[model samples]
Target: MDTTNSPSSTDTDDEPRWKIVGPGLLVAATGVGAADLIATLIAGSRYGYTLLWCAILGCIMKIVLVEGAGRWTLATGHTIFEGWSSLGRWTHWYFGPYIVIWGFVYGSAAMAGTGLALAALLGGLSVAWWGILSALLGLTLVWFGHYGLFEKVITAMVALMFVSMVTAAAIAVPNVPDLLRGLVPTIPDGSVVYLLSVAGGVGGTITVAAYGYWLREKGWNTPRFMRVMRIDNRMAYVITGIFVSATLIVGAELFHAADIAVSTGDQGMVDVAEVLRDRYGDIYGTLFLVGFWAAAMSSLLGVWHGVSLMFADFATELRGLPGDHPDAQAGGRYFRAYLLWLTFPPITIIFWGEPVWLILAYGVLGAVFMPFMAVTLLWLLNTSRVPDRWRNRWWTNVALALIALAFAALAVTEIQKAVSGVL
Candidate 1:
């Protein structure tokens, strides 16, 4: 079973170590997809740097969550799904339907988002065609590439996103005074939606739970890899924090100063670009849009790979398969099945538009997943299933609890938004 411990770096090796940053980068990259960009840009346009604290808090929460997922894998040599299965049948029950519905809905949205970027880049192609092409590209890449290839591609994409976005922010030159005040952590009046959106949207989704799968893929399965995993996870989210913060800075400097109204959804970023063009000229706006595209595409690739992995795990587990049992890991039948599901099913939404009920179901399911993950990780890591020394620290527990409570509130507000539409 290849139980030999993987060799760690020697003390004398002073060279920059890229291997230390592994699946955590992939997780952070994938989790902080287009929706997160939209949320951050919106917050910047609406509240300027006032909600910058929420974005920072969101990054910290994700670090804790992803760290917990990675820690469980390294400590127990079990996948996150395996950890969840140990929680009992209810975990499966919730995850089973959620994966199915979430994949169907998210696939179309992700493809469309990717397509939007492609269409922007290539003016001739229709958005639908671009979306389909993007989906196929993701499917083909993951179908052929192993973990190392996937990680490399994602790392490059994250770098592209970071440079583009950070450069845009630099050109905008946000106010130091306002940015300083934003660090004070005060939510402005009547900003509940802004706060919840920032907190909830900071690079999170069902795919955050896939961190362990990626960890296993990275050959981090023993207690020895624990330190490396922590370093990897922390670095990934720190990058994510910077990307999000830079977006807030751009928002504060550009939109707040001009009193511009940012549109809703992913298009909000496009509007930000337009404002940048009007104010600073073409170069700044074009560069920001390029960065926006990079952010969206990185996320698309992440979802394409991560959620498919989760579904593949779920499918194999339901049939009583082992982790190394041929059909469970990446490139197995179950994995391809999900790739097909993610690529094909959501196309219907592109043509017909997402139904109100389906959107509602997706929102409801998504709102609870963070809490579900946090609570279950707490249970799994604390139990005898994991080594006592590797279990969560007191601060970890407190952070997880706060994450759960915060998501619970977000879930309630989401439900209210859903119900109000019906009434």
Candidate 2:
């Protein structure tokens, strides 16, 4: 993109070396929680190695999505929210309520997910209490800590998740020949839903847009850091691919081989832990639970920090405050307000589970977001809103278009399923 508008280039030009990892890792780790892991495992267990290409495709598409977000920030010196605001007043109308509602539902879901992992580890506590504890812990960390501390803690959790999941994959003894065959992209019969779900759901989410905000938090606010951001984005998703693929291997080796069906929802991961315990030993089972908790908690931490930034920024703009205002950034009043919104009210869901109507609404809202992200990002990166050099190239447009189509289809299906469930 155009480096001229990048305010930080003058200061960062002499910096010695670029870090291989950054906010990208946090974004990737946070996006793939227990539900994602379980989804990948379910795909593997049901279809063996048939859906490996789908997961890889998901990672590639996310790289494009995140790169677009980071590019906008670096080239134009605006957050993604600001870019959306530039589009029209309607952007505000859409996002203002969307963030509020999405946060309320997602908070409980995220906490309950982490709680499931914690309950698996500490049977003395019920899942509801564990979920509440997880939400409180995430709230405490984000409310008290700044970006540096948040980034470091998320990095540590990513390490724990990587090591444990990969080790478990290795123990599963994947069939090399079958894995190689999966790369060729053959969909087994009756696997259309699983195929779309894996391809579209792997690594893309609301958090992909958070990449830019996280980059700002990491002191990479200029085009000079563009190369580093790309490397960071790719590396993070590469690790995501490895982590996801390993879970698939676990599913293939354990559930597929044994012809066992995993449970549904967050508890499914707990079932996997039990499977690990029975097939391997207690230590392996405990290790899997640790990894599960890392994935869940990292997601809780990531959204608590990242989306809160988005929310705070939205609130600031809504109030006509400057983007750089303290209240719009980390550990500020607006930020903490959104953080609490994401941590507390959802606890009710933990105790009673999501009400039927609320669950349906959340499903409908969640279904549309990825497609919204893909479409908006495609628009944002293509126009003069971004620097000419950073505009979406032909390949980038192609990828995003495909992502939009894929996610739109998935959204339709999800909405149908949600409605059907309610009826």
Candidate 3:
């Protein structure tokens, strides 16, 4: 029986909706790392509520993108890669190099991100060592395909992050009027990059592409669960918006109002934690650091698991395994290999800084990926690959086109930034 359209035993018809945290939440939370928070914080510190609207728009963009991914999975029992493969050889050409390169470089960045937080929180080890430890810990947790346990741990961590960051925002008492004005969407002087970052960075990156794999992991495999999935995606990104906005509020109060400047990158996050301590006392700073660590750790764990599933599936497909093959899912041979790829070799990048060529490759390839995903989704959802009834609506098409255009613009800036950083 094709249960795609039926609310069968596996569809959670008996479970209360409120208790079910869908796969969307996992993917959404995974994308909000230390870097994203600092981006929004710097924007707020520099321009007050000026970029708040960008945060909101970024969430909506992700919601649309993720929904398209999930819908493709349920409507067809095929994964995103399978759909990409159907599009033509070009997808294979693009995705093959992109995923391999993206994973190699991203693994390094993810570790450093988490390491910075831990070093800030504990103070016993250097960032590089803490980053290595973070990888080993992550590997141990997901080495054997403990999906249920992994999901639970992520949920707990997300809760920790939400409580701490939101509480800090509350302490800062965000200005009601300024926040309202931000919704009007006017550009301030020299705020283009900040505007684009906030608009494009929130709620996603390659992890957004992992949404379908996450759906399979959560057992929401068919169209009967699509309604629930949309609800979950919407709720998750909305909270993501608030979570990001709260950080901006904190930055506005702590740095902008006080006229203090913030440094760049993840270290900026550490620096702010100290400022948080100086202003709000030891306990508050400690709590905020925990939140920062949770954000970094959650992102690390997510890519480790979710992207591994994605890579494993791609590998399995290459060897002609069935779509439902065990090897294509978590704990498979390829899955473990990719997990190692995400864990071990990148430790060297932590010890030694990223090479300039690697940065440029990472930047250019990484920049193009967002547009690749958007344009591809627009293609897949509109084509005969999807059931006619399940195709993209006009609004969805318009939204994705705008998303593609927006990401393309950002891609130019990212490539230039990468190039200039090296030069």
What's the lDDT for all of these models?
Answer: 0.81, 0.85, 0.85
Runs in model 1 with CA error above 4 Å? 1-17, 421-423
Model 1 residue 111 CA deviation in Å: 1.8
TM-score of each: 0.94, 0.94, 0.96
Tell how far residue 75 is off in model 3, in angstroms: 0.3
Q: Give every collision pair in model 3.
A: none
CA deviation > 4 Å runs, candidate 2: 1-18
Over 4 Å off in model 3, which ranges? 1-13
RMSD versus native structure for model 3: 2.9
Clashing pairs in 2: none
Q: How do these models rank on lDDT, best leading?
A: 3, 2, 1
Model 2, 148: alpha-carbon shift in Å? 1.0
Best by TM-score: 3
